[model samples]
Every structure is written in structure tokens, then in C-alpha cells.
Target: MRHLPVLFSAALMMASTATAAPHVVASVVPIHSIVAAVMGDKGSPELLLKGSMSEHRAVFTPDQIATLGTADLVFIVGHGLEAKLAQISGSEAVNGKTFIQLSDAPGIIKLPVREGGAWEPDDDEPAPAAGSEAEGVLAFDPHIWLDPENAKAMAREVAVDLGKADPENAAAYAANALAFAAETDKTSAAIAAELAPDKGKPFIVFHDAYHYFEKRFGLTGVGSISDVSAQAPSAERLGQVRDKIIAARATCVFREPQFDDKFVQAVIEGTGAREGVLDPLGAGLTPGPKAYDQLIGNLAESLKGCLGG
Candidate 1:
């Protein structure tokens, strides 16, 4: 009877004490990066689809789902940006908890899909896509976090969400948000100047992932070449791309870090345009650099090396 009383008291004390910090499972490294800045040692946070894994086609393993049970928040790049995330999250990944969609965040600027098969509206007129943006089905560019300024905004939003989840640490979350935003601004400015009058230059990306970057820095992405997230284009489609390259005289065609480079090699042949890979997922694959500040520097340096070389 005496031992039972002690055990009951221990259980009561345990129940009275506060729980551990909530865990966050991020769908993209950039999201994880920003959140990590705010979380510091406060939360258990990890990147899920990591590295070159296409967010659009990320496979949700049973082990990954098990980890999700521990997470209080799951942050995803929205608007179908995370290929099958909505489905997996709703059905399995979220573990019955709600997740935040970055695409839904305030200050997110969505791009319109041009009818002429371009990734954006004309430089002169920026209009939302037909039918979709009108109905508010897809209002914002899902890749807003790609731009450092916008990423700062996103960081604030995430901080607010985190604060709501842990009111006790609300002050820390806000402070971290402000600090990270300042850092992002500095990083972005450095990158913008490093491009050195090449913002107006033309280049082709294997995917349309960099539209937010182009919009932020006044760069022009000439065209997109592949659907690394989905099916590879057919040979005929590639022939058409070659024709477009000839017509545009683009500087170079960009590939992605995780994709097979065979098609890119074949297409760039005889065109004088070189091959380079843009890493969107960050060091989720390699652990090169994890923070947004370093990420921006890495991107700028990569661009300088690939384009200026």
C-alpha cells in the first residue's frame, strides 16, 4: 500500500509537469531550415523528403509514417508542390494532426501559368493563370520560399504557427523569426549583386522550380525542359525543346541534382549550351549547408560557377 501511494504520486507529478517540445517533420529542406532557425533546441525537427528526392513523388515509407506520430506539425510546400503530400498527409503522414501549407501563408505571391506554354506571364504584364487563379484554387506561387525575402516572410508565418503550438516559447519563436529574416535579407542582397548584370540573361531549367528566384532578382528563365517529378518527356517533345533552344539562343540548360543527366546531355549536344544542376532540396541529401543564409550563398556561388564559367 505504501509503494502504491508513491507510484500514484509519481504519475500525478508526471501529468502535472509540462510535456517535451513538439516535433516537426518538414517536407522540404528550405522549410526545415527556416523552422530550425526558430526551433533551435526547442523542438525535435527533421526534413522528410530530403535531398534530391522530388517532393512531388516522395515515397512515404512505413517508418517515415511512424516518425510522423511524434510530430506536432508537418510543414509542406503546397499547391500540389509536394507531389503526393496532400494525399499521403491526409491519409497517413500527418497522424491525424493538421499540417501547415506554405502556399497558404500570407504574402505568398503565386505565378500564373502562361497559356503559351511558358512558366510565367510576359515580362510586361503579370496576370494569374486562367480559371484556376480566378477561382482561387491556386492563388500563390508554391515556391515563394525560394526567394530569400519571401522566405523571411514565410519564416515569420511559421514562427507564428509555432508560437500558437507552444505559447510558453512564443517570445523565442518571434525573436528567432526576426533574426532569421534579417539574415535572409542579407544573404539575398549578396546573391542579387553577384549575378552581375546577368539577371536578364536566358537559361533553361529542367523543371519550373526556380520561378520564385527569377521573379525576385529580375532574372529571366527562358524555358523548362523536364518533369523530373513525373514522366520524362518523349523524344518528340525533346526535339521540340531543341528547336526552342535554337530559337532562343539560351545561355545554358540547367539540370537538377537528383535527376538522371542522360537526356540533358543528349539535348545540349551541338547547341553550345552547357549542363548544370540546381539543387532545390538543399543538403537534405548531403548535409553540405543546412541554414538559409548558407543556402543562399551556395546558390549564388553555384550560379556564378555554372553560368560564368
Candidate 2:
């Protein structure tokens, strides 16, 4: 009976070890949605930033930093999107923690940072060559998750890393990734069809954050009111954008949920351009397996709504 108790205890411990989920952390809501989808029912990944927090301006609490230090894996958009976490995760404080930069994921297309507010054709600066620095600043557009294809690529990476970390749930993760990819494809096609009528219509965004989404759908973005940093445009800059809005016959001026709309109003004031709201972060939507689809869908609806048929 003594031996049976010992054997039972050993079996219980082994079972617990075998079934425990990996401690994974995701930086932003969109990334969290993808990770959650890939993890499926096997495990849940912890989300770092929540509810419309801009990745560029994200400020982490001390408890969040501690969470990073103890996580088995951390997924982030590396190219300076979550600058604070990126800097902290590299230090010895989180030594031995596996931090996966989905920006570096193979097959994800990265666009260069647009040089000026009005992103004229001449303002398209090429992305910095690999392994070479660009004036010690963020070089590529860090909003890779805006593109469904890019999201698919991120999901594959999350699956691979999660599978490696939790061997017991490897097959489940792989299957979920495949399923998520299919869903993204269907979602992309639907969005493309929804945005077809709005193609070639001139529009202005609050910032140049939607290049990936614009490029993916062949949408016409005449210019942005703010820089990549999302700062409010100066009066001179607003005047310039207002002129462009008139010249381009822009259909709408789109403001982001995370930014102040006063600048957008200033740009469109007396320009006869309607104002619309777009959220790239899925901030208004609940984070979960279907959040990415909802995010992309909402953006399309917003664009089509303002641009008109």
C-alpha cells in the first residue's frame, strides 16, 4: 500500500508535467489574436498591451515586465513597433527567454518608412538593406499584422515556436495554424471584394500606418496628415494636406482610434472631405481567435463607408 501511494504520486506528477501549457506572451492585441488562434484550446498566450494601446507609445507596467522575464516565449513585432519591450527583452534581465520577432518572419513583406506626411511617389524611401543601419532609427514599417498575408506568416511562426516549446501540444498547434491560414485567406478575399468599389478613390489617413493594408488591397492612399510617429500635423502640414485633399479630390479623411481627430478635422475643414475612423489595432474588438478577421473587416467597412460606392 505504501508503494502504491508512492507510485500514484509519481504518476500524478508526471501527468501534470506532460499536460502543462507553455507560458507564452504576446506584445500587441493583433499579435495576441493570432497567437491565441494558433494555440487553440491547448493553451492561452498572455497579452501584454490591451484595448487600443498604440504599440509605438506602449508603456509597460512593472508587473508586465516581470511577466516577460518569466515567460517561456515572447512574440513581438520587432522592427521597433513595441520599442520599450524590444529594448527590455534583449537585456540580461530576461536572459534565456525566447523572444520571437514576427517582423523577421520569413514571407512577411516589409515596406519602407514613408519619408513625408504626404507620401508622394518620390517620398517612397527603400527599406534599409539587411544587417545595415539607417541613421540609427526605425527603418521599416512595423505594422506587419495589418496585412492578412503577413498575419498568416506570423501565425506559422507562432505555431512553430509554440510547438517547439510544448512538444506535447505540437500537433494541435500545427493544425490550428493551418486552420487560421485558411480563415485568413477567405477573410482576405472577402475584404478585397468589399473594397473593390473603393479602389482608386483618393483618401488621407491620420498617419502612414496602413501601407500594408493599402498595398494588400490596392487601395489608393493619397497622403497622410501625420508622420509615422503619429504626431499631430503642424498648421503648415495641415494646410499642405488640405491642398492635397482638394487637388486629389480625396473622398475622405480617415482618423485613427488611437489618435486625436482634431488634426484630421483641421485637414478637412472647408475641404468638403468627409471624415471617417479606422482602427488598425483591433482596439474596439475583443481579442480572441476571430479578432484579426474582425479588425480587417471593420477597416474595409469603414473605408467603403466613407469613400462611398
Candidate 3:
């Protein structure tokens, strides 16, 4: 009888220790980086997508879904960024868990999907596509983490959620988020100063993914070769982008390593535009809290190298 009581006590202790920390899972690398910062030494969240894959077309395995089922809190950019996550969002696995969509976070600057016409005004009102206003559906860009300000806001949201999930470590999460936000501001200032000379300088990107970054740093994006869908622009659309590039006298055309280079090369062909690479997702970076800084820095360096910065 004495030994039985000791065994029961040991089992209870193990169970308590196992559930001491909340298990967190983030949808993508950039989001994971921010959440990791908030969690800090308290805990680490699992990254759903581990590499340079496209989040738009990412396929989740059964094991990953199972991991989501086990998470105490889940974070995603939402707005169809991780299409596969829709399945798990409503599943029983996430029934009692907290889910955060960074796109809906406060102070998030949303840019509309650029249709055939020129850059339109930024408004909460949704406008239709160029000609098919009635039939065309309104879309908002989901690449919210490209801007440091948005990232800071997202970090705050994450810290708030983490504090709720694990109240014992609430102060740590808040402190880490504050520290991260300050660092993000510092990095943003440094990047802006470095690229200030080239502010308003025109450039072309692989896709319509850098509007947040461009709008933040005062850079001008002439046009993107691809749309947000990652679909190749139609021949007429490509010609229109080419005309814009030529008209703006864009000095560089940027391509992402995740996508094929042939299209970018063909677009810039005969235009005398220098080719540069811009990786918004930080494909080559090690996924962690520090990777966000590296991603922003790399983007600035890439722009400077190609745009005479």
C-alpha cells in the first residue's frame, strides 16, 4: 500500500510536467518566426511548412494535421494564404484552441489586388476589376508580414494570445514581444535609410507580393510579371507589364528562387533591365526569431545591388 501511493504520485507529477507548457503551431516560416520570438525560452512552436515551398499551394500531410489537432494555439495569416488550413480550422482538433489570423490584426495595412489598371487608391471600400466590376470578386493581398510594421503588430497579437493560453508565462511573452517590436522598428529604420537614396526608384518583381514593402520604404513597383495567384500573366498582360517597365525606365526585374526563372528572364529580355533576386519568404534563411531580420536585410541588399542603391 505504501509503494502504490508513491507510484501514483510519480505518475501525477509526470502528467503535470507534460502539460506545463502549451503546444503552439504556426502556419508558415515568417509567422513561425514571430511566434517563436514571443514564446522565447518559455516554449517553441512547430512550423507547419519548413522550407521554400509556396504557401498558396502547400499540401499538409496527415501527421501535420494531427499536429494541428494537438496545438493549444494556432497562428496563420488567413485570407486563403494557407488554403489547406481551412480544413483544420473547423475540425474538432481546433475546437477549443485559439486561432489567430494576422491579416485581421490591428494596424495591418491591406493592399488590394492590382487589376489591369494603374495602382488605385488604398481604401476600405472594395472596387471591382477594371471592366468586370460586377462579376470580378474583390481580393486583398495576404502577404502581410513583408512589412516590419505589420510584423510588429502581429507579434503583439501573438504575445497577447500566448499570454492567454499560458498565463504563468504571460510576462515573458509580453517582454519578448516588446523587445521584438523594438528590434523590428530599428531594422525598418536601417533599411529605409539604406534605400532612401533609391526611394521612388522603379523596379519589377516576380509577382505582386511586395506592395507592403514598397509602400513602406517609398519604393515604386512598376509592375509584376505574375499575379497573386502565381498564374503566368496572359500574353496581353505580359505585354502590358513590359510596356510599364519600359515606360517607368525600371532598372531591375526581380525573380524569386521559389519560382521558375524562365519567365522573368523572358520578360526582361531586350529591355536592358538588370535581373535581381528577391525572396520575400526567406527561402535560404534558417527559420527562427532572427530570420525575420535576415529576410528584411537581404531584401534591402538585393534592391540596393540592382537599383543603384
User: Superposing all C-alpha atoms, what RMSD in Å does each candidate have to the true structure?
Assistant: 8.6, 7.9, 8.5
Looking at model 3, the pairs that clash are: none
lDDT of 2: 0.79
lDDT of 2 by residue, 62-129 (tens): 88887887776788877667766655655656653546778878788888877654763222333333
Runs in model 3 with CA error above 4 Å?
1-19, 92-98, 118-137
Q: Tens-digit lDDT track for model 3 on 1-309? A: 011000112232355433666777888888989999998988888999877788766777878887776666778887656765654565555443435677878778788777653232223323333443122213688888998999998898888777766677788889999999999989999999999999878898887788889989999887887766455566665666677778888899999988888878777888989999999888888888898888989999999999993
The best candidate by TM-score is 2
Report the lDDT of model 3 for residue 141: 81
Tell me the TM-score of model 2: 0.87
Clash total of candidate 3 = 0
lDDT of each: 0.65, 0.79, 0.76
Instruction: Indicate the residue-level lDDT of 128 in model 1.
Output: 28
TM-score of each: 0.83, 0.87, 0.85
